[model samples]
Target: MSLSAITLLGAAGEAPTLTVVGEGVVLVPADVVYVSITATVQDENLTVASSESSEALNRTIEALIEAGVDEGAFTAGRGRSVSTIQTASRVCNNSTCVVVSDGAVNLVREEVTIRFDAREEALINRSFEVARSEGAEAGIAGYALVDRRAAIAEAREKAIQNAEAEAGALASAAGLKLGERLEIFERSSPLIREPSYAFDPLGMRMTDLFDLSWPVAVDPFETASSAEPGMMEVISQVFVTYRVSP
Candidate 1:
């Protein structure tokens, strides 16, 4: 369509063929949370320790399952055993002897992961209790909401709108009429985290160590890893190209 036609459509409230990029954002509230409970068992006898740890892990998993937790949300991994080795050398008088030495490391750990929806706060609370009852410690691992596809689309539209306005203003200032949209390039808001929150939870109390407060900040653009949704800024950007009519 011609630039004049584009202008006319804009004036008449009709969809213009001009490459108009719009952006919109919607505040989406999260309604669900993911809770992860980890248990570690250590004993002197590797066999007895491993067996007991396995049983504890299983009981924890079964408890979660019995509470209507989704099977996909639960995981029971094999317990790991670790041993220490040492080497020593001694020399006396004119005779020297090399002795290979090793020490026994008696330790075993079992881990279980459970994921459940927080549709009900009471249910979440109950889950925590159940975990404790099963001799496992649990806490609010993370929070998530329903699919944000629609919200993202809305944000994309708003971005397109902003681009279109800029393009129109540019064309008007350049004394050239606006033309049809030649091309539109868009990318989804990248799911970004913060840089500071990266740590391995190897036999550590993850919940006690990290904070899970409100105002979850996520750049959605910066590609980083944050422990708790680093700073809560969800943003999207878009690029648009339009033709110019003489």
Candidate 2:
């Protein structure tokens, strides 16, 4: 809801505890721009289909490089599949009809996609232009920071401090004093098996993930798509329980 979500619970023999959920978020510019090219081709012969795809892919890469994109900035892939196509039609002669022989042929379909980091402003715009001129689909895949873990580390500290501040303020309003933390929990990403940062209440916090600088791109791509890295979020949240003196 708000920046903090608070809850209160008590038991017969234990001190009343206040639990609050705090959140932190940071917006950072994109460090890298991902440019992509895709080509879809079909032919009766698999060899021909693969060749067609390769030709289109090569053309796009060459154009990108010629536009000042280095070869080291490229990533590419290709895939192939086969399916049957119907060609023959039924023929009838005075109520006598015969099934056509060899009415189907194998059609090979191939797909190729080339990706690259168009880190420079000049190369970034040229990437989309090259893909478009070469008869290939042109688009930007995404933008991201180089150091995501460092961003998360900063957010984690803010969330913890925010939780503590909210608890203290709410405790004071209720005529009680804030005490030591009883339990600490981190709300991490479900998709991530290993979190970027961890908490240790034993006076030993993870130091390797923090105190890092993420330099912004020298020339940020003006949001042609309106969905640039400026919208990306490096966020952290926590649920903290604290004892409240009666």
Candidate 3:
């Protein structure tokens, strides 16, 4: 879709006006993936809940580090606490109702985010496994392209070309000649959306540490040995404006 506006130049006394607006879009594959690891603990004791949640998060972070992920690639988010309530209701013979409350239990949750190149599929999968085994939940949050600026620039050039073509067609239809460029305005910025992936362990059992035949391995840089990686989309949009003469 496209739109345009006309503006008179030179102190509103000019005979010629400028007509502008053109848009272009492009799609590219995402090159990076963002993974989110969450740890949650619920108990009557706030301290216990918080401690357990923190430990789970720490374990996940350590696993990622062991998998060859740089320490800088992970960020810890703010911790959150919520009250879980339990309620009981009783009905009397006269259709009257009485309600009793058992008070509230505190639940604490913490999260860590990991950013890495999508090519590190094995490492990403290993991180998920480690987080889950540590009693945390892990999933892919979204995907991103490494060089968004370059993609936007390419899309912008295409948009300008589109605007020129439209201007030429409009000028021809109006029995006028396309003139020199007067103005270029961007209608909107580039739009990109990263797709989310749900975690599915596929019933893979955790290797038993005591089983020497299937000994637990500790490698930080290893990618997923089995699971397939996911993909995301990157979109770029550009708008342009030009002038015409009779």
**Winner by TM-score:** 3
Candidate 1: stretches off by over 4 Å: 1-27, 30-32, 66-107, 142-146, 165-180, 187-237, 244-246
Score every model by TM-score: 0.54, 0.60, 0.69
lDDT of the candidates, in the order given? 0.55, 0.62, 0.64
TM-score-wise, the better of 1 and 2 is: 2
Model 2 poorest ten-residue lDDT run: 213-222
The candidate 3 region of ten consecutive residues with least summed lDDT is 208-217
Query: What is the C-alpha lDDT profile of model 3 across 9-92, one tens digit per residue?
Result: 435655454465555555566688889888898888888888888887887788778778889888556546566656566646
Who is ahead in lDDT, 1 or 3?
3
lDDT of 2 by residue, 1-246 (tens): 135556676879878899987766665555666666666566667677667877877787788778877777665555566676777656799988876765555555444443344346666777778877987776666655665776677777877888999989889988998999988797454111121233233322133234221111111221122233334556566889999887
TM-score of 3: 0.69
Total backbone clashes of model 2?
0
Error of 3 at 79 (Å): 3.5
Error of 3 at 203 (Å): 40
TM-score of model 1 (CA atoms):
0.54
Which residue pairs come into collision in candidate 3? 66-220, 67-220, 67-221, 68-220, 68-221, 122-223, 122-224, 123-223
Instruction: Give the candidate order by descending lDDT.
Output: 3, 2, 1
